[model samples]
Target chain A: MSMPALLDLYRVQARMAVQQQLQYRMRNAMVLVGFLTEPVVYLAVWTAVAKENGGSVGGWTSGTLAAYFIVWTLVRSMNVVFTPYGFEWRIRTGQMSASLLRPRHPVHYDLAYFAGSKVVWFVMWLPIAAALALLFRPTLRPEAVEVLVFVVAIVGAYLIRSLLQWLIGMVTFWTTRVGALFEIYMVAELMLSGRLVPMSLMPSWVRDVAGWLPFKWTFGFPIEVLVGDLGTRALLLGLATQAAWIAATAGLLALAWRGAVRRYSAVGN
Target chain B: MRALRLIALHLRVVAMYEMQYRMNFFLQLFQSALATGTGLVVLALVYAQVDELRGWSRPELLVVLGVFTIIGGVLESVVKPNLVRFMEEVADGRLDFVLAKPVDAQLLISIRAVRFWQAVDVLVGAVVLGVGASRLTPRPGALAVLGFAAGLLFAVVILYSFLLILATSAFWFVRVDSFVETFDGVFQAGRWPIGIYPGWLRTGLTVVVPVGFAVTVPAELLTDRSGWVTLAAEAALAAALAGLARLCWRLGLRRYGGASA
Candidate 1:
């Protein structure tokens, strides 16, 4: 009822969620290792390409490319959301019914779980990233202003990507084969978000379409911010676009949750 | 003869089950189109900045991409999903039923769960290979085709052994899904020619991970550039790995008291 009581409940939930995540330390470590490999491999490939192309391609020097992808690794991992497991398991086992019966909205619990789990992953991943930075000798210019903007963008990107993926996972309420859809989404993210390659290297039309989509803001824009590639106007525009997507996706998630709950209740899952 | 009949029956059952979901066929087609489009676009983007990467031209790299997709399709459609389930079954003790069957348990378990929708990837890969080969210098010859087929078979065997070893770990570890995910992540590096990477990475892909043999060596064969010794080594490695995987599976089953004799 009161704000303080609500905050207390959130705190308690967060602690429990964090404890649950810590129980699977080995699995978490393996996943973090797996996550780190992607960015590292891409960094190597792009570095070679840059070398072969006379030390820079698309305005990024070898060192900047290294910095971009290394930051990309850490930022992307921080924004990683595991909504499918919770969504699918809840739907399959009728745990969602109990959640719906709770006093608070179900998303509160999910958000708490997401935040707590990311806390665990972040602790484990930061050192790995630091080690990579040292080994690769990435030339990083840690601008204080850019760092602040990057932090904000990272938080914004996490919210937007998580909400969107959660909404997609909600489709499990309708179909049993959501895994395929999830895979397709991952492939799209790998391309559009500059996870596979930098957006500047892609065709101009492809870049335009990717920029129009929310996926770019999730990884590409933030990495650009960290790399000092985004000018003043572009940085502001990126933040604005991220905010717009967060709002739009949050609204869609609400509508989808309402419909999904109706389906579950009426059809008796 | 009876094993052939059982395999046929399994195929029929899988086909009947999959045919009910016509939407899946279209969904897989869309997904494969997106995947192929993204790979090609990335390659085009990379080549836009450079004339050659480690002496491989654009068309040569495209050929590599084609083989990678084709091998990936075969693995997903025939080997991966089934062996993944087989690993789960091994954990749950249901693999005993498979072992008790009259047919060869390995063959049965390996081919039992085909997602026929993955045929789209195979078809798309064929088209990509066709286009890529057409763009190659001197064109592909009969020897190249034979080498490509042989290299493909060798690649499939290597991939199968890699997966089996990973899945067989479930017999001991009981939680190998993460290992599979790690494999998937590492395998993404195969999209490029392995020669482009540094020495350590090249060695890891060839000897440790075996992704190079699965995708790159075959592509090299298709381009008619790889030496006979490379093909021979790849085949030898595949055979050795497959034999080792079989031995591990047998030992793992022994631990569960599923030994036949």
Candidate 2:
């Protein structure tokens, strides 16, 4: 597809997603509320710990901790891509056959659909963010450049997660054990990606390991852009790293799609 | 007694069905260990920074973690599967079959399904609890054990009532699939002692969700921090919640427009 045609496809798919998602706003709101509890738990724990430790632990005061997790809620919502389980379902139900018949890549459709849903999620997230801010009193103040970096970084985080998860989803073509593998991936992300806590709070070895992996770029980097006081040079470096992960994962996904498609023997009607 | 027999019958069928997928038990073990390991590491990190967490020493906090796992295991293995099934049935209008059963509809619905593999978490939790108890300078005595047993009984009752009340909401709204996820997220708070939270959230966890009562109160009994008065209060709360749940279930039943009706 030409560039304009591809853009049009994304526009149409995203519009459709927004329409479909809006119909179930109540359901989505419940899920969003469910998402809120995680950060609240984390915030409450870390704040208590920080307070007990003479008002700081590993350079994270209670206010900054609040900002990190509150921003975590948004970054998490931004990076909610299509999961590997969905891929397993699509192939088992022969939905892949319908998708393959399309002229464009199937990933584009998913990318657009989830992007559209993010629009609705962002709207829903506003009231939630406000409530958290009021309760936790998160101390978030970003410069103009940091604000610019955050916007680019979140988009980068979204693309990187989407492509990597799509690559993981492609594994369903070979085996049905993707659930176990996905759980493993999630644990690694939880520990290494700064999802559970800030990297500063983690041991140095964990921080060093996280630097090499793509998980940090998806979660910790984008969140730190707005939450932490990273220097301008470090912020640019993080964005560059996010771009590199996006490129590498997209390239790997393109290769994996070839093998996955060839291996696919469509199942359900 | 009839409820016990019904649960036993369901367990037998679940066991036979699960025996075919024996490898899944190993998978569950691995996942449960991974989760438990992560919890321990977080505790390590927390304790590394301070001697105690708002009067909760590391080992005392470990007891809380263990109780959290055990309660979570019970919920996932029995309560959650049934609750999800109930919600799905409500949404699809298949609940008529359940309501027509010979046994009490509430009892039947609550005991219908079990994920046998998920019970691995209970074993994992017991092992953690044993290790935590062993580390205490003065180990827990028989009185502590008795209190723990009673606390656990009340905890399960309260947790089950909470799940039933949540499931009963399906009768009115018909779709609350995300309720399980929300519950899981909120339940994570029980990993820490309820005392660590602010006054308002602590009260919310205690009364609104009762996660504090379900996990922390039991752990406190094991650690000799709570007395019989607390246990008696919990017992009363459990009875009241059970009554409330029954009332809610009956009221919801009146709203159930069955598929065939």
User: What C-alpha lDDT values do all the predictions have?
Assistant: 0.82, 0.89
TM-score of each: 0.91, 0.97
User: Candidate 2, which CAPRI tier?
Assistant: medium
List, residue by residue over B1-261, the lDDT tens digit for candidate 1. Answer: 877887788889988999999988988888888889878877877787888887888888888888888888988798888988887787677888898877677788888888788878888888888889899998888888888899989999999998898888887887678877777778788888888776777888888889865799888888877868888988899989999999988888777643232
Interface RMSD of each: 2.0, 1.2
Superposed Cα deviation of residue A177, candidate 2 (Å): 3.0
Give one clash count per candidate, in the order shown: 0, 0
User: Which regions of candidate 2 deviate over 4 angstroms?
Assistant: none
Docking class of 1: medium
Clashing pairs in 2: none
**Model 1: per-residue lDDT, tens digit, A126-177?**
8887887776777787678788889899989888888888888889788734
* Candidate 2 local lDDT, B1-261, one digit each (tens): 998998899889999999999999999999999999989988998888899888888888888888889888998998899989989998888999988889998888887889999999999998888788788757899999899989988999999999889989998988787777878778888888888887888999998888876898989998889999999999999999999999999999999888964
lDDT of model 1, residue A167: 85
Model 2: DockQ vs. true structure: 0.76
Computed on C-alphas against the true complex, the DockQ of each candidate is 0.50, 0.76
